[model samples]
Target: MSLHDPAQLMDERRRLEGLGLSVTRYGGAIGLIGLVLACLMGFIQENGMDRFFFVYLTNFIFFLSISLGALCFTGIQHVTRAGWSIVVRRLMELLAANVVLMAILFIPIIFGLHSLYHWTHAEAVAHDPILQHKAPYLNTAFFLFRAVIFFAVWIGLALFFLRKSTEQDESGDYKISIRLEKVSSWGLFLYAMTTTYASFDWLMSLDPHWYSTIYGVYFFAGSAVALFATLSALCIGLQKSGRLTRAITTEHYHDLGKFLFAFTIFWAYIAFSQYMLYWYANKPETTGWILRRQTAPMLWVSLSLIFCHFFLPFFGLLSRHIKRNKSLLFFWAIWMLVMHWVDIYWLVMPEYVHQYGEIGAAPFGLMDIFCLIGFGGLYAAGFAMWARGRSLIPMKDPRLAESLTFENA
Candidate 1:
């Protein structure tokens, strides 16, 4: 169990066979019940279907961004030939692979397009010049096609990295690392472009007229924060459940906390950069999006993102002692995860409310909570499914030895 005994890592409890089975069963049940209840609430309430789709989209984007962030992080580690992360990379890979699950969840949003997006309406586009101008790119067919392409690329990259990484587990071949490095070099470029355009299609186009060149980066920053927080939380949870108790150490948690802290700042920077540009430009189309969020309720949500999302966490995570403390890191991890959802909700709900002419009304409701619980359960189920009968860490990764012996200077 000691770091000096690298050979003992091979004897670690790599598979989650016991705990994973229980999580999959209970998490799937909870997910299904939550989704069904949210559906019933949507039908029972007035204009509830509209609220359902927007709330669903908000939660959808929130979870999907986490997977997308995982994919990006996995690729970054591979391309950089990172050693400190081999102990944790498999967790990221599992999260990335759940993009396949996100693809399945996306079907509901397709059906809700008319409810969620203004540009999806043909008559409205015909009358509006801006929508007309953006029509070629925003039409239903093109939107779906782009989505398919995005998922295809993401799934392909996810499977390749995961398959090869797992293959290396058996073969213990260093060549597998070379192959992964080659793919990741170009894989990241594709990741950047697809995530950018996908965010544009899914989130930005909600407001057909508003545009920001940095919106994709904004999403990516938050996604990175989500991935690190989720990873930190997962590692802590796994250790608590008596899995990988020694293989993953305080050292790894410290590094995860540092990334969590770093990306928290990065997200705030991108958020402010986007906001500052809109404030400085004073452009009607872009400013309209910002102004809508400035109204009551949402204004409070916006303020929360400013303080809770950034300032509060910035100071809370400033100390090395805090990052190194497992208990403290777990708290910050959970905190960042909640803030990331608020950030996604802030990005999405304003447009949904603006469409209903209820700019003053806060869109927070039971349905949002239900949808979040639904997605959270399903996310847990999918991750557990991928994790079952598999090593919690990449047991045979070439750099795993380095990770096992890694220390912060």
Candidate 2:
């Protein structure tokens, strides 16, 4: 009955694979088709290509945060010697691997720098005193160099942890556990630094003239929320496919829901804190950023986020029954995912297109859907590939038995 029995664990994994493969394959195919259609739409629509380019770049940056957040989760599980999560950590590892795909997607962003980022243009920078001062740090060369370093650090950490975990799966050596613990302890620190800086470079810099000390933390909060929502959805979908039925229980769903709930609050707090501080100070520079968002149609989008992203989820997930109920949880998870996209859209689009009369639906074009589909498809494909031919759970973990028997107090 010991969960660490290699023979039994392998047998269970084989059984789960047979059940899960068809669903996973179907999902991946649908995702691929959606992406292709989106791309075509982008090309067909007038001025769509430019909009698509921006959407693509933004989604690419957003995926980078998700991928890196997954890396952070994987490292934390190892460092904490968390057994309950051992069953799910491999899923995270695979998601982390999508960081490579995200890095590849960054090419469009690099090429479209002039279009997506105003500060990237010499004419724009020269006219603005603030941008001119920031030119040294915000120039194309430094931007590219920082991006390369960010990916190098992220990919290095993901591969190292994944490699070590796979090696331990084969050898079943205790020493490998110790090594992972050591690596993840330091790796978490690096993750925090890298993700914060990446957020600053990719997102915060969109408004180069404006700055917030709390912007990085705000990004982290949103990233964690988005990632938790993704994990919950994935787990629920896998379970419905009749995989991980026994390995992952309602308790796991409950725990995931709690994290999602906590991060939702954190995201709201950071967002409000950032806004409140700027509003109270009433400084021209800080208020200018808010001014762009608070007027016209963008104002409605901001209000929608308050309701969809914070208020709705805040109360919707409060019930224990809802969190543990597979169907309800799945619905909420999908809702949160959509809201996160809107949140990002609100954050980046207003700044990029503020001159277009404050939102007015911001011209919901094919490019947005195409970029999302393309990036999401690639991410799903990478995850599926990583999940293939591996034990979904770390069966050899010393605490596997404890995890299987875990229950909420």
Candidate 3:
């Protein structure tokens, strides 16, 4: 059968029964091992508990950002009614659904509240006027309430989209697509507000003395970069495993690479904008956050991000050939994913050092590795579980035809 034949596209390889089972088995095992070792390291090392919570939060946010990015793009494609993405939209839905798993993973951060947030200390709040001023929004009860609301919105949106998209697979109903487009319109608004406030509450409040109006956008930009990189990598991995080989063509990958490239610049733009504003203003509260990263070991990390995160990938992915070539695109995709982690590490690890009185010391260590592996393994397992018995592409999407034959102009 020809590769373009719709009748033969729904082959046995399009489903993930065997692949999903294997990924689930190994992914779950590795996750358990990583989590166990991370726990041991947390207790066995000095100030281990504190380090544990901070690193845990860092890894949690890193993975969470990927899902948030997936959710954002899923809504975006629907809102725009983009046809080029239908061939790969199922992967985005699968990734977005992992937000449920991320919610469960948030439990550790809740327990570490007192250790992670200086504002959580009653004594600190009493002494610091700034903390007192921010008290209403930063209090533990309100923080928890906001977290619940955030998760509720995310879970509801994720499940709704995933459920509806999957239903269309069985029902072959184009009206479901219309319903999704309608939901995505308002869903994006809720996503924007929740993501912004969540970033403020979870990350910005770590210091309690610093604030940035654009921090949420900064986070969103990096998440966008992560999302595109993830989708590209996953699609390549699936093709490599001999699944979705026909449905997801080079054209789909070309589009994914373009997104990855576009968002890499977007992330850099937002990052530099935030830094430039703070630098120009020279305000102590705002400058303090940037200063922490500019000093010592973190200073190197900061400089590296400018080059590694932006410049290197920016040039590497600039070629049209690179975007369509599976091997090259996969390399940049993995490269961007690593750089995205570094970006998150730079945002987070400085605070961990500043809090522990290890201002000059680099925070890199075995625990960071352990936490990353732990979270990563679980993330893979969740993705695999979601993929089980499901089509790797939206086999019946109204736009699938357009996507399958899509070509760049």
Best by lDDT: 1
Cα lDDT of model 1 overall? 0.91
Q: Which stretches of candidate 2 lie over 4 Å from their true place?
A: 1-8, 14-47, 355-359
Tens-digit lDDT track for model 3 on 1-409? 1255555685737887787898888988888788779879989988788988988988999999999999999999999999989878889999999999999999889999988999999998899999999998899999999999999999999999999999998988999999999999999999999999999988888888998899999999999999999999998898888888878888888889999999999989989899999999998878899999888889999998999999999999999899999999999999999999998888888898888877556787888888899899899999999888788888788888788878888
Candidate 1 backbone collisions, by pair = none
> All candidates' lDDT scores?
0.91, 0.77, 0.90
Against the true structure, candidate 2 has what lDDT? Answer: 0.77
Error of 2 at 72 (Å): 1.3
Clashes per candidate, residues 3 or more apart or on different chains: 0, 0, 0
Per-model TM-score, in order, reads 0.98, 0.91, 0.98
Model 1 segments more than 4 A misplaced: 359-361
